[model samples]
Target: MKTGKRIKGLMACLLVTTLMIPNVAYGSQPPYSDKAIQRVMGKIYEPTTVDLTGMKVVDQAGAPLNAELKFMLFDTTIQEYSPEVHANNGVLDTTTLIKGHHYILSLADANYEMKNKYFTLDATGELPKDDKTNKNSDSPERESFDSITVTKREQTLTEEELKKVNRIPFCDDNNGAGKFVSELSGTVDMPDMADMYINDYDVKFKLVNQYETVELTVDEFGFLQGDMIEDLNYAVVMETTDPELQNYVLLQDLVTSKNHQEQGENVLTRTYTHYTCNPIGGIYLADSSYEEGQSMIEDCTYAPLPSYSKKSTLDGIRVFIDRGRKINTDMPGALFKVFRDEFVFNERVLEETDEKLVMDFDTINMHRDEICKLPHGDYTITTTLPTENEVQAVYNVDRAGNKVEDCTFTQEGSNLSIETTSVSLYNTVIEFKHVHEFEKIDGTEPTCTTTGVNEHWKCTSCGKLFADEQGENEISLEDTVRPLAPHKYEDGKCVVCGASDPSITDPENPDPENPDPENPDPENPGEGGTSTPGSGNISTPGSGNASTPGAGNVSASKKGATAVPATGDNNPFALWTILAFASIAGIGSVVVTKKRKSN
Candidate 1:
């Protein structure tokens, strides 16, 4: 048994060992140990100093460099210290770096103008890969060190140096760093005279490099003054946000003056005055690409740039007046007027001699003329006819020659040509006609009604009223009648009309000698029968004088006789009281029987 126990213990030990073997083999190795170094050799390694020799320096063209260029060596492991070294004759021979550690080789002076380069040393003779140069194997190496070649960096010019070489001119002696004035002068020419003036517009100048913009309003002399940078190029843009000028095309130009002095002072001045032609006008006959109809003034000068022009031809419009055939008499004298933008062109009276009025309307071509020509804008034509009178009614004719009732003169703008259809005149004749006149015929005075009619005068000539025929205009005289009040009956008599209700009977006057005792009459009590408590010959439950428990009885036996009240027979709960008493007695008997049997 002891041996068996020992064997069992041995088996348990073996099982535990087997379970721990995998964990021990796969566990993490100690930090910085040989096994740890082997595990992380490629990914991480200890930093140690290694010797570097026979390094050479050259230019980008592969020529050897002879100047003494100072460089810095940085140990990535201990980044705080960066030792300086000097390279001469394109060689650096005395530098010790770490194997498996990263190192940076950079020019010691920022003015050296070269980017820094990094290298990692490995004792296994593996070269580090460069992101730009990759791995180069063209150089011979020493027994204890590696050789590398570095190139000289390109130099960058300073700001002042750049300006000197480029020969950029400035407005001021201090490299154009002062306030300067900019003057803009120009003349605008339009095809048609407009209310717009030179002072109504503005010019904007923006310096591209400085990110500055300023707006200058034009003066009455067609000149604007503002501040600008002397050494910078400007983008001169002329525009207007006014609602009246939004239709005009905007002008823009890039202006740069290499000659600081144009004619005199240091002021940068330019002249650009060109009108933006309005393109709204009549149809054009020329090619759409050419602007033909409108011409600019000789004095108007632009920035010697391409500009847009508008050309158009003026077309004639006609106006016609006619007297409607519907009028039996001559047409009334009427005034006709034509206006364009508050400018009246024609105003005349329409008479028998002057049948129609003809006027010329101008239409401009948009392609040729930059703007719409005069007399082509909004036009309003108004006609005034005679007012309606008792004898005749006057009206205006529509486009289809239909007579318009109550037509009045309108002053709204329209593009349609004036042409009257027909005017009609009728004779004034008085005629009597029947018209509705509401007369109250039923209610009180001043009541409204629609049942009565009165005679009203109507004109057969122009449908006008001159007189009203007299009619019954007072309240209705039929009657002030109402429905009878509903009847109410009480005790066989109506309470409202004092009439007898034959359907209702009086209990007090019921059939004599056969009257109902339940409804006894107060005045004649003996006629029905008095309901005295002990006098009625009715049998009541538990009315005898026998003394018994559980019996519902109340006796009046002062004279040795049990007299039960007749009202006891009318007790509503008499049956219920008797049943309760019997139930108690039966339960008591049942209990006694059960107890006796148990004993």
Candidate 2:
């Protein structure tokens, strides 16, 4: 009887030790270890529970609730949720989790009653209801509870349950009207929603001014088409009433058509967004991976239902491509590339409606009429060809084909700007002008007779000269000439070029060399004269009296005179008389010519 009691006592001690094993194992480590937090923040955790594992929650009726679950440690001392332990989306890993620690599993659900649910894990690593006896309550109405006996269930939703959840993928909308039509046909579009099941439902149009409901069938292209009543100023609400779309959040449900009669038909578009809410109970800290004192789940999922009652003031744009006189036959065809503007916020592009403008050739053909619907923003148009085929000017035209004077566009080489602000089909005429490819023409060096041109530029294809490098300032061929230089003559012959002066009668016999006027010969008093043509001195024929060369010249008529023997007689007197007569005759001829006139 004593051995049996001893064995029973040993078995009871082992059971006690087993119950305390959890605390002893977790005691050495800090509460809410950093490694567990890193797993919760795997790169970046989305608000949805799709990435979470190990637990599945259900409602009171045993239906699986698509709720976001968050596991947090309870501080026994404070009697509240603590930062010591945290696991996102009910991710319970037995190897990593602490033993014997009281943990609270909170739920974030759309249903308000189910949102306040909390579960606890006891000393044996089993989840059980928090009974009110432990300062907690099984009744969800009571805010706080501790001990309660409840059923523990863990199973994922069946395929049928997932289908019933009904989450419609968010669709992107250009938020602008469609193509221009001849008549005012009302159109409704759900952009990028062709493949989704919700797109097959009919759109309901409720006229507010009149008690009428019209159902428009969705076309094969996944859009609604109908015509608004002519000239009836009744307000219309285009919406979806299908019960399957109850969970989807409508982002935008209406588009205001401006000048529908003037610019033809417009399209009314819709936007729907889907998201799963995240739990919002955690002590946010500065050192945590998320924001300080804030929850990423709450911030991301919080949004009010979108409402659209205001009038849409959208504008339409029409492009007229004028391939102006392309005179050069050798040049290839010119192409203009269009670019829609993008609006960015916080390093993210918020709006970029269309990027396929350049991809579709028929849409932006050279001369075909193209009318496009665009949001109110700036746009750029540029040439795809080389600089030789650049845009000359861009004119904003009216419906009457006349240029609009109110708005002006700027052109920087090949680029042109356009801004849509009004309902006018603001005709944008892109007139392409041929640019000149001017090459530098080296100038020719001028000579004495021929004229040469200065440095200038000439068009490679067309023979046109321009003074400036940009080819703006045009110049004539004569304007670029370096004038002919005159012949520099010295002693009846040109010094620069060896050409004789035409005015000289006989260049070889040039005349008696003239002496320097500033210097006088010492032998001849106060006289500056050159030497005779053949000799330095003139020897008188009759007398030995040497007439020193003075300011007098022997005439060319006396070139062949023979030297007579010195007679020392009347020959010297007669020689002076003959020279005096010759000088007088020569002076008379020059005077007569000076007074003469052309007949």
Candidate 3:
């Protein structure tokens, strides 16, 4: 036993000595130094420096990298990892990365992107096989450090960056998939409702009354969005909330038996769906199929009613069933009128509703790795998204996160769209004011005096009386002002004043320069007036003959006992006879004087 123990001890010493030879004998090696890089989830880290300069790789102590973990590469290792990198398919297998080489790991579909094209030299070197084992390691780590260079690292992503890189829009587009249904129906029994896929009704209303339904369909921009419909299915039923086929039977019967008398009492129902891009309007079938829906065509005739049927529904879109159809452009004038009215309502409601449900989808779609797909070069990335149209905006968030609210990058479904058009603010202003004109406006009726011309006619309300001192067709204002004179004859003289009423007021201080005294109204022509002598007090007869007053007529005296005739023609008959007698006496006296003188 003693001999055995000595031999065993010698053997152990030999084993220890052999293990120490590599570290001590290799004088050019560094002092017991080693390095490692920790890789996780296909990502590599900076190499960890360990004290392995004076030791072999097998002598690594307190290894940060576990020996059982995958060892990608070493310079002298003769092992190879299987599975090559495939850039096209984005598969990063063990063969994609050289073992023991510094590399970067990224979470992306591009993890399989191949490195720059380079040729591999066949140096007749055996790469380390990972499953191989020596006395120290049974399955050695595959090495890549020998021929590898860490020139540059591919860009890596954070958790957030990873989300951006891997995100794809899934069901982000609002599939306006429920446009075939409705919540409200109308009161008109239009048989087209069957072709319109109307099977239920929520609010049935009276005829000609309005009912609105909010349909979700692709708008003019051609994407799923909210819209409105007005009176699509006119009915006159006391509406209920049933979705059965029989919900519209009574109305259908009335419509099938349509007549002028039947119209007042008939009703129908429809369960409205959100509207669609191409509205489900009228349909046309071959004229031969008239017998199929003859009752509907003949009875429920708005125009020359054509038959129709419900066709296939593709992705919730109800395509029409125009079975062997022909064009019906001039279907009927009356039908066109109804269609025009309803279409107006339809467009109006759509315009109003697009503004209400204005939220768009682009604000949520994110840009991804594909954005950087060009050749390696400098670039600046931006993102955009959309918001609600409750506010008028030139800007919005785009499919990416950058603020592109300017709507430049915005597409149809990317913005809160109002409609195919921009709606201006509706402002109806009505102004009320009296248009006064100093004179009558051209083409305006010339107003005349409303008062009557009869002598008894007076405006008792305004306290105005009419005058009958008549003219050819009018009366003078002076005559109209006061009561008319009792007689109509003048002093056989013509009047110069036509209708002007001149007031005769005496002037306080008469002046030749000013026509009026007491500052009479300038508009009045005769407020202050001048008077001249007439027949009274100074009237002379024809050819300067004076008129003497008689006893009862009353004469004036000029300081005389006997009244002198004021007229120059005043003469007495006694004065005339005395003169005659004096002439005879003078003749006789002359004759007598001559006879006496002769005696």
Candidate 4:
């Protein structure tokens, strides 16, 4: 047991000796011998000369470069010692660096961008990657000091120099495979006619794939900048929010460059060009039939046509008329009608609604001299001349007597568009001289066979007809035709004008040539008279009257007239005389027989 204890004491002494001697990999000299390590370990030391040699700037392709640049150091371990340091001949001084702590070396310049490199000055420093170590490391016995160059690339710059430039953070916590943040920038340019500043309107922007919108404030030159998530697949959409500005001013997207990350760019920039349009209008009138009225316009003086102001809106416009040195109602038969001009599809009007007339002439005539409110749109105004006057040529002239090229006139009237200005009109009238020379047309009575005419008057010079003799009311010639009247007949003839009727016949005085067979005459049996005469024999009136032959003959005549229906005959009086004569003969025969009986 004492031998084992002696062996253990020997091993313990050997272990103490091995610990006192420094390993060959750490360094042969004591760590406190270096002033930088002494300062890190809290030991007092004087500063030593820094070693900064044999290092140089290079491009991505490993080519040596000549450029004006700057340098900065960042501490990655316990918060300590971050400073803006300078590089002498492309190498940094290592004497002030802390031992065993990680650092980031940043090389900054306007002409080139250097990526961050992790480095340390002391031999005991730990590296992030096992194989890729910085060139600044120094150790005599470590045998594994393989040096790999950091990648470099050339980059263009803005107008600012290194002092004012914002460089990327070294060993930055906010950068990784999935982390991306960047600035969006653009310039807005407007036409000179807009007369507006970029700050006068509110601008909003949104990403194509994003639903939220962000506000961007532009400076005097319309330069804007904002922070946004970097995206290669998304595009930016920008617009002005003022509702009134949208009417006359519009935004034109000239350049929208997406995929800024793919292009190795930091900020996405766009160019916006704005355009503007104001309202205008014009008018035309022509009345060559009245030369005197035309001369009146050439002699008058009035204000120039009104142009649209910047303050004008879509609903704020006026199209008016002025009668210089004349009464408002001087032109009685003239008509001015205003219809919403819908013929053109300013953008696409015809495809929407097909309606035109807004204010007719009758409504417009009531307010001839008052202010009329008109919207800023396409319009058609029809000016109808009086009956005595005719339109020959229409000219759209300004107050200075110069022709207005913007407005045109047609025979029907004028079509005006109020896009950039306002318009006005003037009119006058003159009566024509004429007289009516009437020719009287007498009326004729209507007959059964012919049409008649009503009394009317016709103008000889104008060929106009009138129902009255004064010729005040005009009528057509066809209105004077009268229809035929019904025929009135008496004795088989028209009583009105003595016209014969073939359908009617007189039975008492029948025509001898074309006698009716149904009417047989008594005097002549073949003719159509009352009946056949004296055909039947008569019986004796009494036993005594039968002795006389003359009395029997008279009685036979009476029986013949009675048998032929004398009451219905046209000569019934002749039949009655025969009956009376027969009666007288019978009485005389009876009286003579009485006298013979008495003797």
Candidate 5:
């Protein structure tokens, strides 16, 4: 019997410990103490300051309940047959109520309830309800009790609140007629949306009014296509040239002062942007890592009113291409040249749209050939216009890649044209189309002469030229010249690989020379001293022409040695020395010959 009792006691102790495990294992520790909760418990009775206080306590009789109520509303229930009570009433626990984001108070029973017997208690809940015991039999027509209020807690902004973007993304849609166009009149800024909206919808319309008009807009999918044949002030138009005009123009939000020009006050310039588009919805996601989509924009997308630019030129057409490069793809066959020397374009215009860019080509394809041929060194094709003109083009310089246009060129109002040319695999392009003021500027041959230079003199006049010591002679001191024909480098030849043709190497002139060499020899076998076209130094045999008794002139090749005097009838020893010392007097014995094996 004692063993059985001991076993029962141990089992009871195990059961109690097992039940306590849950309470101790994962329950949350309240950040505040019960005393902290009691400090602000007098809020339920003061109707005036009800919402002002964060937490409150109340009694069963609607009085200021004692702060020492160490209980919480664990659950709620609804009692209804004909007249239904709140779903939360007697329907859930404190955990579920906190989870659902709201709190409700209700009575436990209907007939057993008194008047105002609905309010319950949770973590600071009030007790507006009194039990049937509190209600006397004379209490006429008992009324049900229920109420709901904010839980007095902080929360994160909802999706809708974040979408508001602090009202920054909203248009001045007062009554909604001219909302998008009215309030915005500035530059560009880009900010990420906290949330996205209707990404799959498209808008198709032809809105027209006094300020703006959409000729024809057909957006059916995720693509954008619209033609706004709008009349804009030249200055205003310039300020909104970027494709993301809406985003960019937000930069204007920072301006505090501006002289608002009345509409139609000035007659300056015009802008026309046509939109021809083919909707292509799904974008090429980076994670996809597939070579998808059309190779070119034209193939996959359509733009009836494709974007373009009217880049500013000094009043007339100005050329801006080198020997074989072209401008603007807009006019594949057209080129640019400046009529006026320099000017500044309107910054606002470029910020608004790139259509005004005169350079028909994106900076990426300013030239048809690969830029790798002439890695982005300081090579520019420029011409002086009638006036002083300057331009700054911001662009992307990808290695072995063409430049990507990224900025607008601002210039003053003047007639200027930039020169451009178009070329391809077969048919070459050599035409001039003007920017700013569209007047054709003819391209004359580079009015300078190109003479061939070996190692010596430059031929200002047309003739064979060399840049070596043996100037324009038929022979070259260094046998090496000319590239390996077509398969060669851009700036002459590859020094390391010895890969080039004669066009890059001028064995007779301007040969490559080494400076601060480890071994300084006038005749360096290294590529550093390979003879170019215009190295200016040559050697020649002496002149042996002279009358009797008059010595012929000659210079010795070895430094510090005097020239040999010709032996004639005047000097008897000269002849005898040659015969008597015949063993040592070999022909041309004054100098030692240098021998080298060829590579």
Candidate 6:
């Protein structure tokens, strides 16, 4: 038994040791440790439980509220408050809370009065009841909270202020009536209304009489209600106390509308729907008695009606009178007149003028520039020269500055130009050449007696000559005298000169030393050659007298008479004649020989 007791003691010792070691196993420990509990306590505190059913709330109208109601909770224990909790339809229910915590509840709304209540929540949940009555019970009574009512009031104006309003004068009016009216409108804001309301106010229209102020009332939306009278002045004044209301008051002038009748005398109305609050002051009417206001006046008068005369110009014609160095002195004094139909519209004397004559034409029913045109129908320009001077010639000059004679003028309506001359004015120069008498130069005829040169005819005015009439003619010495015929000899007897031989006899006149042997008569052949009948006295050939064969000089002894040869040892006429014949025959023989050689 002792052994058993020792064993029990050992088991009891192990049990004490186990108990002293502290329970640290996973399943043996509490669900939460003290450190974990302290950490949770740092994050959150205990809340109070309170019932909010007894709290009362209402709107300004003091009826049961149907809006969202909010409540705020204040905890006395933790010295902190909770976020506001909202209740729909103004009803609050039970809420969780902390024991032994002092709490306060409050509601805030702009449309309603604020309410506050304080109560303590013991360990048991309980709340204090609201004991306040409805605060709107003693407020002023209203018909409906949704809309407000407004009343109209009219104010009178003084006489001086009425007259200060400007009226439309008769002079300023297009139609002869002097009528005027003023129109005005504005916007106002009503309670609880979001947008601006237009033309919703009272208006007081005032006017000045002879000595007093008169007022007209407008009970409707403050617009000018009725038509105004003709030629009447008016001013508008608005009355309102609302901060959002605008005043439209102005001095105006009005006239009658198209629909207004004269019998009704209704003035026109103009509506000004948009306006501001700035005050429009008094008006001032214009004085209509000024002289400038008259529509019609007297005509103006002056000495000369700004007269302008007509003139003409020759565009391309430049008259050079003296050697192309000076213009004609009488050209400037030339007169030009223009006529329209049968009436003379313009006339001008070209005095101290250049080639161009500019004039101002008094056109009765036409333009001045148009009336200045000449030679078209009745319009003409006639140039009158001085009595002492006349236009001798109207010629033009070429590009080389040379005179072009007989350049006649061509008239196209009134435009005159030189024919075949340049059309440009600068390229044309008109000249009036001087006229003078000229002497004719009789030409001499060419002479055949001697060598002479040709003579040409010429004029004295301008030393110009005609073409050559005759060429030079030379005289031949061989042709100055008659030539003797050549002698033909047969059987030592001369045939032409009736000599035995031409070399030994004279043929011009028969003589004893030289005689015509062919004519020697068989009877009386030695009787000194009895004189042939009708034959002149025979002499030596160079001595004289060879009678012409046809002048009834002939020898009766011979049928064919032969003349005596010349007596001179050298007869120049015979020698020259022989030489000429020989030359001719020699040339003919040369030509025949050449021809034969060629053939």
TM-score of each: 0.18, 0.21, 0.12, 0.19, 0.15, 0.14
Best by TM-score: 2
Off by over 4 Å in 3: 1-198, 202-425, 433-489, 497-599
What CA root-mean-square deviation does each model show from the true structure?
40.0, 33.9, 37.4, 39.6, 36.0, 56.0
Q: Could you arrange the candidates by lDDT from highest to lowest?
A: 4, 1, 2, 6, 3, 5
* Clash totals for all candidate models: 28, 11, 64, 12, 154, 27
The candidate maximizing lDDT is 4
Q: What is the lDDT of residue 341 in candidate 4?
A: 20
Candidate 6 lDDT tens digits, 328-371: 11222111111111112332322222222222222111211111
Give the alpha carbon lDDT tens digit for every residue of 182-265 in model 3: 111221122222222332223232211122222323323322223221112222123346444222322110000101111232
Alpha-carbon runs more than 4 Å astray in model 5? 1-154, 158-164, 167-172, 176-415, 418-599
lDDT of 1 by residue, 56-149 (tens): 6665566666777777665433222246877788776466666544455655432333444555555433444332233221112412223344
lDDT of 4 by residue, 8-78 (tens): 34434533454444332212222222333324323111222233233555555655444445666654332
Off by over 4 Å in 4: 1-438, 448-450, 459-464, 469-478, 485-498, 501-504, 508-599
Q: Worst lDDT window (10 residues) for model 4?
A: 273-282
Q: Could you give me the TM-score of model 6 versus the true structure?
A: 0.14
- Would you list the C-alpha lDDT of every candidate in the order shown? 0.33, 0.32, 0.24, 0.34, 0.23, 0.31
After superposing candidate 1, which stretches have Cα over 4 Å from the reference?
1-47, 123-599
